[model samples]
Target: MTMTVRDLRPEVRADVEGFARVRRLALPFYLVTADSLAYDATHAHPDSHYRPLVAEADGEVIGTAQVGLVHDSPDPGQGYLNVYVHPEHTGRGAGSGLVRAAEEYLAAKGATRLYAWVLDRPGDRAFAERHGYRASRSAHFLRLDLAGGELPPLQDPPPGVELRPGTDFADDPRPFFELDSETMSDEPSDIDYEFTDYEAWLESTWKHPLFSPELTTIALVDGRPAAFSAARTDGGTRYGTVMTGTARDFRGRGLAKLAKNDSLHRARAAGLTEAFTGNDAGNGPMIAINKWFGYEICATEMRYVRELG
Candidate 1:
């Protein structure tokens, strides 16, 4: 069993599909597709130096790593690598090989701190500890049975609020951009990100193929975007809310909940059978909201951090 690590060839359909396959097998609750992988490989911000890597044995991709610098953070030298090996091929050295390759690449690129997301299982935690990575914050992957679950009935917007699909702002998405930028700053994470580049956002997010404007919902207050639920689909029955947040000024008006519920209904109407979302473990408010919608925590991932000496 000779395992080797190399850069993912975006041009090769097999490589792309194999990487996506490994990810799907390793992290079954999340939404991932070949098209999304290909898009990120090319459209990521240049400063991030994003590289999709694969560990192959006998001409098959057995493991994958998404390695890149945290370019949006104000601080430099912060890198991240999320490595996942196919469950059937776990003991064949694919995971270790991919991790070593990722660390070397990030170190040479001047990264001082590296973070990785490891599942909360005992074996996964032990693996991270063995590699000198210490546990940090954690997050949970949640799922709702969009097809069988009964969602709360839709209600007309309160006096000053209106619900709009993301498509409504197609002519001018700057409002969406502004709302996203503001909400992201409030998100809980180890790294504080600042979204200052509208051009980059437009290129990587607005134009991405998997982003479904029709399924996304925005809550408007007095004609101003207050909160939004951004959706991503795998061009299948799987649908995920990648971001759902309320503007700082709009917090606690039930706008975020309103937006997400509307988005879920829209996804259901669009024939998406499953709804997925992620929440920081410490985010009790958001977790309560998700629970209210019948979303159950499907899986948990622990964030592990290591300092490169």
Candidate 2:
């Protein structure tokens, strides 16, 4: 009945595997894999002070915490620590221990405000409330059946608009970075984020292990990056659209939908079976687009916040 919390050791295969397993059981709507777990441990932004943790009982990893600062936010002192305990391991002290450890870690790193995502369930909500966390914003995890559901038939882009794979920009992703930065600046969110550093984006996102250049689709307007659908996969059947957005000038032109549909078609043709994505609960436009694509709301999670004293 002994329990303790420690830093996640990504180099240790068992540790990453156990962490991935726990996440899959607790949050199946999103993508999680051993390779992703290990990659983040090594490639996360250094300034974020990322310190993933795990709570172990009897030498078995039962809970995990993804702790880090809001490195991209212009406002400093913002941090996040998302904790999850294995579904079967709940009721033990693992969840609480991990939360305590995560809070202390972020505080030491100068985090004054903290955010965490808790699933929208009675027990999960109650757990956050007990920890002094206040529910703020909510988001939905959606799933589409790439193997069976009828995806929208691909459509030809309008005059001056062309659809292309992300691989076209493999030689130089600065254009994509510029477009992403613009769309990201105004996405529905509780915190303000600015992707000012191109190098940081290259390290943290463009070259991420799960990003699939071949499956990602971009909508170009007269050879300029206008909208894009970023896809990530585990080199398997499970695919996820991490981001789909149109530049400010093209927001109402249906480019996001065009790019996203192209990506979905590519994923299905590539043998991907399931597609997943998430949208802020208040983001009606994006939610509508997902619904149009036959994505069902698989789960919902609320953003829980607490100010550190």
Model 1 TM-score relative to the real fold: 0.99
Error of 2 at 247 (Å): 0.4
Please give the CA lDDT of all the candidate structures: 0.93, 0.94
Distance from true position, residue 83, model 1, in Å?
0.2
- Tens digit of per-residue lDDT, candidate 1, span 1-309: 778899999889999999999999999898888888998898999999999999999999999999999999999999999999999998778888888999999999999999999999998999899998999999999999999999998988899999999999999999999999999888889998999899999987899988999989999999999999999999989999999999999898889899999999988998999999999999888999999999999999999999999
lDDT per residue for candidate 2 within 187-260, as digits (tens), equals 88889998899998998788988999899998999999999999999887999999999998887999999999
- Candidate 2 accuracy as lDDT: 0.94
Candidate 2 has which clashing residue pairs, if any?
none
C-alpha lDDT (0 to 100) for residue 24 of candidate 1: 97
Return the lDDT, model 2, position 200. 88
Q: What does the lDDT read for residue 293 in candidate 2? A: 98
